[model samples]
Target: MELLQLQYFQVVARLEHMTEAARSLHVTQSSLSKTIQRLEEDLGVPLFDRRGRSLRLNTFGRTFLMRVNKALFELEQGRQEICDLSSPDRGSVELAVNTAGTLPAILKKFRGTQPFVHFHVQMLKVEEMHALLERGEVDFCLSSPPIRGDEIECQVMLLDSILVAVPITHPLCDKRSTTIAELKDETFVGLKRGYPTRDITDRICKSEGFVPKHVYEGDEPARLRALVEAEIGIAFVLESSTWGFREGKMKCIQIEQHDFVREIGLSWHKSRYLSKAAMAFRQIATDYFNS
Candidate 1:
């Protein structure tokens, strides 16, 4: 019934020579014999037909052997799968983030070094990221306006500047830079309220004396970027996220205010065990930003 008992039974059953099985198992013959004896007693049946120096499987032992072999094989497969999960070179990471800005670069860097590692990445609101991390649904979380709690551990991974992004043909694109006060009347595209970027933008705008007039709001930055691209509205975007702005149709301008910045951090539930992949990702993120 015990796994050890089943393993001993398997080795003994296969060799059909108790002495050889004991040596292969690195155990004394006497100890091996007692273990087999106990297993047979537990099953209430004899497992071997004994000969002087050799043991042969009896009819009942043969039938039981088939099922035992299958069970042992499956258990071994499970162990191998767990080992792969724990391995740094071959594993999967589950991550949630509030901003997608610096993430792709860090991920690209991680993939260059650990190409076999697979990823499950999500761009989520600040509240959603905290909830998922608390529930242990994700292994790591990258968030702006970083989350904290009794059950969570967090590290501020990066400090990113928020920039004003406008369509190439827009009037503000001609300016070297602009203040929140000067741009307050312009229509804006942004993430919805609960997102850290949205919250920060709102606070910064109010500190400059006006709530931004929203022309559109969404959860995804790409959508906001598209709206910016179409000249529908300018957007407050992370500097790292302005990747496509210059190459195609948008222009980016740095805002002078100190509040136009966000703290990006990595977080996880303190109670949840980190897989090697998640740990590697955490280190990679720290290195990427800290540099």
Candidate 2:
């Protein structure tokens, strides 16, 4: 009927004596007898045959004992899983990110130091990262900022400036730095509208009193670089995002007229309680960056 009743039936079935089972379970013999009687009454069957000073389990009691033991074992396993999820030494951390530049270092350091914690990293678009955080699908996100919402909390992790990407043969590639006005006549390959990098580019061009004439719009870093190699259009990317530019035909030019810098950071829903794994990751990330 109930878990306690099932447990009493199991113990009495095993010991084959009401007094012995109650003594083993730390209960009174009368209480244990009453519990077993209630269980048998609820099931509409006798669980044991009582002879003179002896008890033996009936045929139905053997089958029911097997099922009850299985249920009790599964219940105990579920309780242990919940305890592991709450413990700092044995929980999982789910992190979402739009860019990969800063993630590798953090992952390497955290894994090395806290080997007990497991990590689940999701490579997603800026919009996807925000939506996942809002829905509580991820614990936190590492992304470029100007992430606006009253329900979100953000901290500036690092500062990065914009770089102008152009093919080596292009005329602007020879310059060490370029202004927004100087890039007005150039064709641009921009990130999609929803991304933070694209927003930064738009803000910079607007400050210079012009909207960029985009020849292509995409979010794939590789494709953006390929378009630059074809001399199709220049692109604005973070300085760190140009890590492999020297291997390709493209060169990076620092943008000088406006600050055009973005703060990369971790963001999460303001009201969500962070799991132990997530909290440890936040502390490790902050220390690694600050150091």
Candidate 3:
């Protein structure tokens, strides 16, 4: 019933362990248990199914947890709004990104204009970015294959060409441009599954009636240059990333197919409120990409 009770419940529901949840909340286990007991009594139903030392959210608990999350989110948004109103020129923007290649330049430009504004950025996978956007947790998401949903407003800011990077000595480098089918037999050095680039390129390969054979699966696309330069495996390189590659070591050949392009965009939950600083950051990002 009390705000403190709801907050404690949220932590407990997330951790699912009394000792761990109590430690996280910085409260004694007995006190946390008493608070949860009081909350369950107030609601006239047990929220979690207990098994010795572990706890699992039951059907009622799952349903109630969703509402609790929304309520807490709204309260936090209200607090942020008040802070923004008091200091319109100085506020934090919580942003999540799928592709990190172009973010540094964009952020540097944003900071140049609004030096006082704070940016809290996270590099997230597509699904993680979507969850944060839907929960009103992030102010905006700069993602490739932009986050899509009925409640989200997504705009494509950059259409980066996806190119196949091969070692300078490789046979493919002899051609000016190549198609996905031609690279089907080549060993690929790609980002792991769940990455937007990996997913987008994977789909393109699938449509070409072949699956890419990945010799090295990594998290950073920049590292692909080293692997390709060593002639270990070729990679699908974003056009933006080709800037860092040494020219004579590797060649980034254009994907002749039209579908082999990455769509990088900014997305946000349409219902979520954007502060002055967040809005300014959004505008700066749009202009930076467009220019």
Best by TM-score: 3
Candidate 1 vs candidate 3: the TM-score winner is 3
Tens-digit per-residue lDDT, 1-291, candidate 1? 799999999889978999999999999999999999999999999999997877999998999887887677557545545866667488778888866767888999889878998888887777888877765667888887888899889898877888988888988788878877788789998988877778888987787789999978887877877788888888988876764445468888878755688888788888666666677888888888877
- What's the candidate order when arranged by decreasing TM-score? 3, 2, 1
- Is 1 or 2 the stronger prediction by TM-score? 2
Q: lDDT of all the models against the reference?
A: 0.82, 0.80, 0.88
Query: Between prediction 2 and prediction 3, which has the larger TM-score?
Result: 3
How many steric overlaps does candidate 3 have?
A: 0
Candidate 2 residues lying further than 4 Å off, grouped into runs, are 1-86, 122-137, 146-152, 243-248, 269-271, 287-291
Clashing pairs in 3: none
Q: 251, model 3: CA deviation in Å?
A: 1.9
- Give the Cα error of residue 71 in candidate 2, in Å: 30
Best by lDDT: 3
lDDT of 2: 0.80
Tell me the tens digit of each residue's lDDT in model 2 across 62-179.
Answer: 8888788667655654554575676758777778887677788888988887788888999787777887665455668988772546778897787878888989899987789988
Instruction: Please report the TM-score between candidate 3 and the true structure.
Output: 0.88
